[model samples]
Target: MKSSYLRASAALACAVVLTACGGDDGQLLLSGTISGVTKPGMILTNNGGSDFEVPVPANGTGLTRFIFPNRISSDDKYDVRVKSTPTNVQECKLFQNTGRAGFDVTTIEIVCTFKTQALGGTVSNLKNDLILVNGSDRVIVPAGATAFTMARVAQDAPYGVSILANPAGQSCTVANGVGTMGPADVNNVTVTCAP
Candidate 1:
């Protein structure tokens, strides 16, 4: 038991030291959106794959906002997943709102948009923006467009989380909205498109 206690103490001490030293880059906030077109409700995990829940906001709309330690080391990359599936063969989508200003997406707008070409079909521009993910081949609609509600996953992102994606041309963008925390309160975070 004593050995276990000592190990735990040492681990915590390391975390603190890392947190402090990581702040040098200044405060950077990570923000973005997660969509649930295949499922309803979302879950945030620290692991790059899947497993575990990070902190979330009070009211969820696929939108979320939170602070990250000054340094977003390899350990900070978090995976955001959701269970917002469609009822039938119809298309579905959900969004995650990372509550950081000037970040990837202030709010993510997801939707069914009917079917297009890939993954059985795709969701087209219900709004106006040009964002197409999943196996679908359609442009993302802008906010306030028809079928916009179906596009969001959460109001904000889960706390202490981040993601990345591939296909350089295909990148995630911060929708648009106000952030909650003050700039100084956060730091050194990255929000990349995830696979």
Candidate 2:
């Protein structure tokens, strides 16, 4: 009878311990929302670990969200940051990315901006007022001007520079003036005028 009582007592003790250590690990998932992601290659990190890349949405929604693979415990300090930005984007900034992991934090925001490059080149023998144009954008180069710049163009965009109006008493032509705008400024265009 005493052995049976001790066995029952041991079972009760095991139940109590199991109840105390429940299934609640208390880890929370971390995620964020993103917008203006024009190109792929956006990589994110959490506490300098758990690196992951946020791909550009193929559904054409522009990547409305993302999630981290790692989880954090309640009240644990967390730091999330962008490791790299997409191509054609100047930078990606994170908002509300740092805080204590008290709950499932999903309000983090990421915004990105496109990179722009200036379209300019050297001009020689420009003795009279001249008008240059790239699409609707125009630039009026005064007499004796050695160089000119159109308007800034977004990276990976197409640009075709041409002469809107030639100078009086002179005929000028543009060389290497038609191409796409790269990541750097274009300054190789040459314009030579003949009398």
Best by TM-score: 2
Q: Candidate 2: lDDT over CA atoms?
A: 0.84
lDDT score, candidate 1, position 99: 29
Q: Tens digits of per-residue lDDT for model 1 on 1-195? A: 999999998788777776664433333343344332322333333233443232434454433343332322332433333333333113445455222333332243334332221111122232324333322223343433332211221222222221123233344332322232221222222222322
TM-score of each: 0.21, 0.63
Clashes of each: 59, 0
TM-score of candidate 1 against the unseen true structure: 0.21
- Model 2, position 15: C-alpha lDDT score: 69
Question: Which residue runs does candidate 1 get wrong by more than 4 Å?
Answer: 1-16, 19-31, 34-75, 83-195
Residue pairs with colliding backbones in model 2 are none
Error of 2 at 157 (Å): 3.2
Candidate 2 stretches with Cα past 4 Å from truth are 1-29, 57-64, 69-78, 86-90, 100-106, 114-118, 125-127, 135-137, 152-154, 164-172, 192-195
